[model samples]
Target: MRALFCYFSATGNTKKCIDLYQNYLSLSGVESDIHNIDDGKLEFNPEDYDMVFFAYPIHGFNAPENVLKFAKTLKKCKEKKRLIILKTSGEHLRINNISSYSLIRILKRRNYYLTNEYHYIMPYDIIFRHTDLMAYNMYEALKGLVPLDVKDILDNKIVKLKYMPFGHLLQIFMLIEHPGAKINGLFMHTNKNCISCGLCEKACPTKNIEIDEKGKVHFKHSCLMCTRCAFYCPKDAIVFGLFNSWKVNGKYSFQMPKEEEVDKHKRYCKNSYNRYFKIAEERIKNQK
Candidate 1:
């Protein structure tokens, strides 16, 4: 079967999950093409592929505004097409399950039916960095689960989140992040650490970061709040405005460090994080 992956990955977590899916799906004899949603326009039609995967990182309990806009960009399908959602979040909160509420509603109107949905827990880019150990664990767990999820999709299984009352309404309420993100982007500025390398300008998904002719970095209102400009900044120069204190800079190694005792943020989301890892472990073991 052929598949199309239309994904928005900021900070690489979602893209990393997509990479795992692509590798496993290829092993299962499926050919796939990818379209990074940030790369301008959608050139592929959903009807051309057997199945389409909509993947993104959950932002503020909902899909980012760009994802919603991308959904609108799709041409209405002539036939009932299958679409699967693959989302990644730093925390494993059920509220995040509602992230797809708006996206699915738009796609459904276009005649694309939701077949399966999968969630992956990945390292955080904002609100505080996860411990290296936690990052390693989260990445490893998702790696272990990707194959099983691919197999389920290949088998034509239907997997979806449990029914949540007022899911759509709750997601609508969370839409405040759409504007909040823009305002926050305006607040983003560079400090003395900025060396005018212009990396942030080139990496911003929304083209929100612009380096003026005078070497001044300016942030525009189009920011999707993906935090890619700040998180992946080589010099850690981009201050994330009001959320600067919570900004997590640097890419995760996703490697098990030899001395692994760094658990400074262990109490941040202890119970929920532990429960997610434990459940993921059980599920992986069962799948084996």
Candidate 2:
């Protein structure tokens, strides 16, 4: 059977999981097409695939806008397409994590059947660094989930690991209380170490970062809180915290590679550039 895997990821954890999951599909003899949720409508016809695997990170209480937009594209289709949502979150979503309720509702409205679903606890992709051992264990646990998910999907069984209204309630609380989505970029600043490299500006999905011709960095909002700009900054120049400039610890950056960081970036950059940053550029270009 033919399948499509469409995903949106900022810090690479979701992408890494998809990469590993692809092998499982291959072993099961399922033909699969993998695409990032970007660039308007995907090239393939939705009806052509037997099933669609929608993979993405759980941003706060919801899916990323890009992923939602992709789903929106298929809203009016009359085809009865099956869907499997593979969500990656940083421990908040132990299983399907009730936050998916909203997404499932949206898809249901669009008339798509969710045949299977699962979630993986990816390494902490935000905030402070995770301890090395903790990172390893989390990675291992997430990796282990991949095989089970693959088998379940191949068996045509629906898997719901957890279901509770409390998770949905937590989403509401986080939405009201978590300032990360509202003002994350507001506190970001470019320290003296920044080489005026435009990498962070390019990495951000939200176009919240602007680097002028002279390399002066500017932070403005509608931040996704994906922390791409902060972690991908080569110089550790972009920091998010109250009074960021005064922090004695200096700006924090992700030096810890998840295995050949530079190599993985090289392989994944072009795809991500096409997937996320290009959309941001187009939005700005259109605004002008």
Candidate 3:
């Protein structure tokens, strides 16, 4: 069966998992193609492929807006038998709520059966300045949870048992709602090292950072705090308190590519920053 694996990865953590899945799929002899959703538009007849796997990061406990748009567009097309969604979030999977459930219902109406849903943890966003080493450890722990026979489970009617649900619930409540929860402190002040290149704004998955009319960097409340922008920054101006100094020890070791290299990675289809800017501008105009 032909399978298409489409994913949206901002910090490369999701990409690492995708790569692992691709390798495993190749070993299983399944014909598959993997593409970053940001590289180009996904225009395909759903009838041609037996399965569609969506891998993306969770934003504010929901799928990124672009992924949601893509899912809606797919539902408008021909029917498909199996649809699987895998989300990578710093948060646990059990908190998968009404928003995610609603998306599944939309797909069901369009004739795609919900096969399975999986969630994995990743490093917290540095932008939010809340780095949880425990979350990173949990992400690493998930490597052991990968099923030996993903293909066998694909067409199975049962939602396979995976993850610790109670653990996930506890995590969600403690991390998001608990008053005593420690903040990540990701958005520290910009230093003289900043070049005003606007790379941070473009690299951010949430479109949280933007250049105001005064040409200063501004952040919105919608940010997921993913550190892709800061970690990917050339000048190293963005910091997360002491993390900056800690990261500096590994300086020249991380090998962050040049701005051109970053621009070429194609994580978002077209530059989402521009689209978000236009939307923000329209909202401000309407408010006035």
**TM-score winner:** 1
The best candidate by lDDT is 1
- lDDT of the candidates, in the order given: 0.90, 0.66, 0.55
lDDT of 2 by residue, 53-167 (tens): 8888877656765666677676444877787888877554342376566667668777667888777655556533444444455465555667776877888888764667577
Model 2: pairs clashing at backbone N, Cα or C within 3 Å: none
Report the lDDT of model 1 for residue 260.
50
| CA error at residue 267 for candidate 1, angstroms | 1.9
The order of the candidates by TM-score, greatest first, is: 1, 2, 3
Cα RMSD (angstroms) for every candidate in the order listed: 1.1, 12.2, 15.0
Q: Candidate 2, residue 215: CA error in Å?
A: 0.7
Backbone clash pairs for candidate 1 read none
Q: Candidate 1: global Cα-lDDT?
A: 0.90
TM-score of each: 0.97, 0.76, 0.60
Off by more than 4 A, model 1: none
1 or 3, which is superior by lDDT? 1
